[model samples]
Target: MRDSFEHVYQLLTCYFVKVRLVDPDFVFDIQTTSCKDKRFTWYFWCFGHPTKTYKLLRPVVMNDETFLKGRYRGSLLTAIAIDPSNHIFPLAFLMKDSKTTESWT
Candidate 1:
């Protein structure tokens, strides 16, 4: 799966671009080593509503990480907040090769 990192990176950039196209407020970031290497990291988030909407929601957010049990092992990190309507509002998501304090920070 090492060779697929480039493909995954391309797909994720495309996905984020499409999301931003639909909702310009969405924000995303991509980080990687030098072009000579292919290790990559991605982070994306959307407020889902106006800035005022955030004040209505609780001022609490939760984060979690889980190891992926798939062909290419990795970790999925997610940030979630509870909206005023009591529905889950996913704020951010990240995928990384491993779970570590460095990555989480």
Candidate 2:
């Protein structure tokens, strides 16, 4: 670990990636400590949510060329649906811009 923001970002990306981009209720802060002197001083912030985020994942039939942020950034041409279990499941999302099919896969 070289002590950078990307290190913390990567560690977070690898660990707490269960719910995608949405944050939980109690995850209130992010900090990094540097050894500037004999004492360890940490830099941090309050990133917690004041209100809870409730999402009702429903079964959706979609067809759109949307924008999605990947690891390298690219166009997200996708069709997704939420199962009855509230899981954000991915459906068929790969097609041309003009090709209109009933459903993605």
Q: Please name the candidate that would achieve the greatest TM-score relative to the true structure.
A: 1
Per-residue lDDT tens digits of candidate 2, residues 1-105?
Answer: 345544544464244344334645323222223445322112112223322222333635555675434332323355555657766654443322222252222
List the candidate 1 regions with Cα displacement exceeding 4 Å.
1-6, 47-53, 100-105
Most accurate candidate by lDDT: 1
C-alpha TM-score for every candidate: 0.74, 0.25
Model 2: per-residue Cα lDDT at residue 87:
68
**Clashing residue pairs, backbone N/CA/C < 3 A, model 1:** none
lDDT of 1: 0.71
Candidate lDDT (C-alpha), each: 0.71, 0.38
Pull out the clashing pairs in model 2.
none
Model 1 lDDT tens row, 1-105: 234645765687787888888887877777775688756654555545547556776899899988876555678788888987889988778777666577667
